[model samples]
Target: MIRILLFSGLFTVIITAVQLSLNYQKETEELQTISQQLAETNAPSLARALWELNATKANDIGIYLMRIGLFKSITIKNENGDTMVFLGEKDIEAHQTSIKLQFEYSGRTGTVGTFEYQIVTDIVKRKIKDDFIIILISQFIKTFFVSIFILFIIHKLVIRHLNEISNWLNNFKPESSFSPLALEADKGSSNEMVKLKSAISEMGQQVHKHSTGLEKVVAERTAELEKLAYTDSLTGVTNRGAFLQAANEELNRSRRLSYDVGVMMLDLDHFKAINDTYGHDAGDKVLKQVSQAMANCLRKEDTLGRIGGEEFAVITPGADKRGMHKLASRLQQAIAILNFSFLPDNKNITVSIGYTKVSNDEDFKAALKRADEHLYTAKASGRNTFITDKGFLPRIVS
Candidate 1:
């Protein structure tokens, strides 16, 4: 851009110089022709012809010839190496130079002279010079303003957009938050810069899409891993580890909010006997049926887990001692009503259940232990019955 502006300035100067030089030369030629005619004739004819030349024309011719000598620094001279007229600043002694002229007449020829003179009173030279100066100054001013305008446009529209793109690319980072680039397209230009911005926008979109896809893949893999870690292989419910973790979380929430929580420990009565008599396949079927029944009985927020061989644990949030009693009885009755082919002879089966409400000072592990103790008590009293914590105070109907 700078180079273009500079070249324009230089071009203007050269053109101005050429135009001024050409006008001066053309005017000077006409003046020389008139001067030669003057030199050809006698004095009376010369004087008459000179008088017939209008004042304006004479003044114009004199000024035109003078400016040629003035600008070129050359005086008009005759053949005899004498000055006919001189114009401009005269310092011709440096070169000791003169000009040549040929004089002609109707019947004879003559010689004229040349000499250096410092004075320049010719009006045409001054006017031409003044006009040339005005033109040159005007062109220079125009060129300067044009250059400034072009530079300003380049900085504002081109340089500014490139700077913004560079900064965005440099600072780009991947995170949960998404960053977007939305630069405005050029209004009417179809230049290389516009194409480049379009390409960059395309690349940004592709990169963003790729990042989003990778994040989704990673999330899916994480979910798969969590499912494998927490689920039971045979029962399709939570494993012991997940059950404990879930119960602990629920217990903590209950404690913080002063809410009641209950735990139930259930075991299929004579489960080992059934497995031994009817094979493990029948035992597995019975386990699946019991798990489905528990799932049907539990709410969405309630948790159930397979803790051991034919034994299950349940966590009920916001359930007090009375609620625990009712839930345990229901679970026992549901199991009693279940008829499984565990013996291969198609005999009915039942489950013993024990439940306990979480106390304010007790943790999940302690509460679960108490529920286990109650489970053993129920098994000792009878194989297919349920027992709650009779020691719990003020049992209300759940």
Candidate 2:
């Protein structure tokens, strides 16, 4: 954008310069014509006045020219190499566009003193500046609309299709076969970016012979998928990889529909301490109990994933700020009072949760980071709590 803006600025400047030069020359020519016409009309009186050395008549002519406001200065000089009368300031502006002309008249049988009138610009520079400004504004308006039009075309011809492909990639499931991706029949633009997207979409959809054993192909495909399925062996919930994939796909969809999503990260407080004191088996039981407790609090559409060890992440689609608070509170309460009487000393576990609402345009990782930040905030303000814009609180609901 910066580069485009700079280029636009330079273009406007260049065009403004050209427009200014054209206007200046045009106005200068017109001014010269007007000056010559004025000098011709005043010729007879001024020549008679200078021949009789009538300062009054000569001064009157000078005053007439001055009153016209075209010339900055006026002076009448005699032909005897002498100054007859100087009536106005002799100083002229630097690089001023002006014209000087001499008017002579034959009085009887002799040449009279000359009338040297100087005409300076009354509108050339101003008109040049005005032309430059008009051209600049015109260029700006054209550039703005053209830029918007180009962006719209790119979005329709390439960006929308590319986003569609990206969403498919995010939702790719090895266990399922997707129909071939094809572009609609529109030959409006043939850009390389669009072509590359078409190439990527065509990768796995190549037509091949189906003459092999049908059952054998199905069996081999299932086996291959079994190896790639994203599932946690221990908790039986989503593993980290599966969580990211599903969440990313959900995010892409939410963005397209302009809806909000929410994510939460929780750390079982003193999880390592539990393992150190009661052993790995007891820690395993705790993880399972907490996982179940969280699951019980969530809707069917919400996702539960064990990030690793005692850290877990959750993604809830279509959850706004109010929903985010209610959901986070329910999970918090569930985990806080979890019953583990079977463990020694009737041990209970508390979780510190960090959460944030996700917008469609944001990355899942960014939402995760915010959730983790709130998680840290919860942990920092004393464990067994959740952080919101309202600060850390133990129970958000009555």
Candidate 3:
């Protein structure tokens, strides 16, 4: 806007200068014409006076011509080349015009004298200066007003809408909804501002759409990663770390509630012998089946985990010693009934179980260690049976 005003001012100045120059030239020409007319009209009379050698009359004519404000000075000289009259100060730098004084006396023309005048250029210059000032002032005022009007139109139609767009961008959020960009001055016309608003609106919508899709994709990926982190690949059961974490949480709750919780460790009996005889594929099949059977035997409140190779653990919340014994017995029965088609008629799968009640303020690791000790005792006694701190189960015939 400032640049516009500056250029407008410059243009006005150039126009004013050109106009002033032309006016100066025109005024100078008009002054020259007036000077020539005055010389033509007054020369005959001045000549007669000089021919008569009347210095007083010639001086009077010179004073009158000077008073007319055309000539700065006038001089008349007789045919003998003697100055007869002079009026006003002679200006050497002023424009001078010389006229020959001739008189017709009874059809005979003869030179009487010469009339010379200097045109008053100072007065003409002053007039031109006044015109220049007036022209400059008027031009400046016109340029100023025109520039201001243009600026106002631009602000109303363009600048204000641009400010609105800037403010909108500052506040825009891709996750949230916003009103579409609109320009009040647009009047629904497809001008530049309207096109800009439409383009920005479309871009914002695309960003929002992509943002939403990206968020959904990120959430699904996070769920998959979480599952991979906590689930056992072979048995499809809770992995060791996740199971221990869950057990600790349950233990903390049990301690606060003053309730008894049970921890149990179970191992497949002679698991290496089964793997050696049946290959790891069969061993893995047996493990998966045994884990599923144990999970089915347990209540919903219990958590089952594959804590090691051929080793499983269970956490039972709000359980008593009798509840633990019943759960352990169910687990044993479930494993005993499992049938492997590839196994010989004489071959069978079994698990040894050990159970313990969690003591007050005991963490899962301490309780699990005690349960593991019971499991070792059960395994040492024989296989295919369960043991607790209080007692051991009678051996079941396979």
Candidate 4:
């Protein structure tokens, strides 16, 4: 806003200056033209009237010249230096800075009288104000529209995309492969983060020979624990390890870039009731279906894992409060659309979600706890709703 105002102010000043210059030039030329016409026509007629001593004709001529609205004062005099008629407000002596027109006889035999007039600056300035305002408004409107266009282009092509890429890099891990980002526009762009990941993977393979004896056994055991830590054996999605690793990487990157990271905690609603009513086989089928349904809603860059038997975690890099809410809503809808067939009658599945964002000042762990608290609030308030940093989810009527 300040920039727009400054731009408008400078433009107006420059235009006003040019307008004043043109007004002065036009007024000067107009004054000179009118002086020539009056000398040729009015002066001869007035000289005839004066020679015949006709007061009425001289008075009419004086009044007509005054009504022209250009002159502030008009003085008429005879050859004897005696004023015949002075019809004006000011009575200043005619000298320099005044226009003097000397009248002559029918054929310039002798001088009859002189008409002296002065121009008004205030009148010229008043006329210029209208054009001045029009020019100012036109320039201001043009600047306003152009500024809006520039901001829109910057936001669409630069700001939004840059923030999105920064977030993707924050969530990326050296151990993981380069996956497609969430943004459809970014799908074709092979970013630096992917190259870095490829390089790290190649380096890890080269160092594989160092694992020998105790080192080999320890590595094997560690790999087993890591595999168990991140993946749910039944669902085959991300495990706790995947969620934690991504979250940690995002937090570390966010600290440097000052980008916001969002995380969601989701729990399957009434899963125990489904298990108690049906067998363990039915429960497993429902769990797999629920995970798959939610996964369909997520982007390739997003992380979704079964952290526990009935609870899942999602990490969204580069999401603010609104972004977190939007993702949560989509996941809720995906879960709502699923249908279960193992039961005697068809049943619908619903999940409650909690969401929070890690800002520049926060760590990922604190943000996770806040999200969990909101999740607990969501579960306590109702069974199948989402609670976010903003508030509880609004119920959709449709």
TM-score leader: 3
Q: Per-residue lDDT for 47 in model 3?
A: 78
lDDT of each: 0.71, 0.75, 0.84, 0.73
TM-score list, all predictions: 0.49, 0.42, 0.67, 0.41
Compute the lDDT of residue 371 as modeled in candidate 3. Answer: 94
Q: Record all residue pairs in model 4 with backbone atoms less than 3 Å apart, i.e. clashing.
A: 230-239, 230-241, 231-239
Query: Model 4 misses residue 30 by how many Å?
Result: 99
Q: Residue 22 of model 3: what lDDT?
A: 85
lDDT of 3 by residue, 159-185 (tens): 877888888887778888656676455
lDDT of 4 by residue, 317-383 (tens): 7776656677787888888777766654456888888887776777777888888898889999987
Best-matching candidate per lDDT: 3
Report the C-alpha displacement of residue 250, candidate 1, in angstroms. Answer: 4.4
Give the Cα-based TM-score of candidate 1 against the true structure. Answer: 0.49
* Per-residue lDDT value at 241 in model 2: 92
CA lDDT, candidate 1, residue 13: 79
lDDT of 3 at 391: 44
Task: Please give the ranking of all candidate structures by TM-score, highest first, separated by commas.
Answer: 3, 1, 2, 4
- Looking at model 4, which ten-residue stretch has the lowest summed lDDT? 94-103
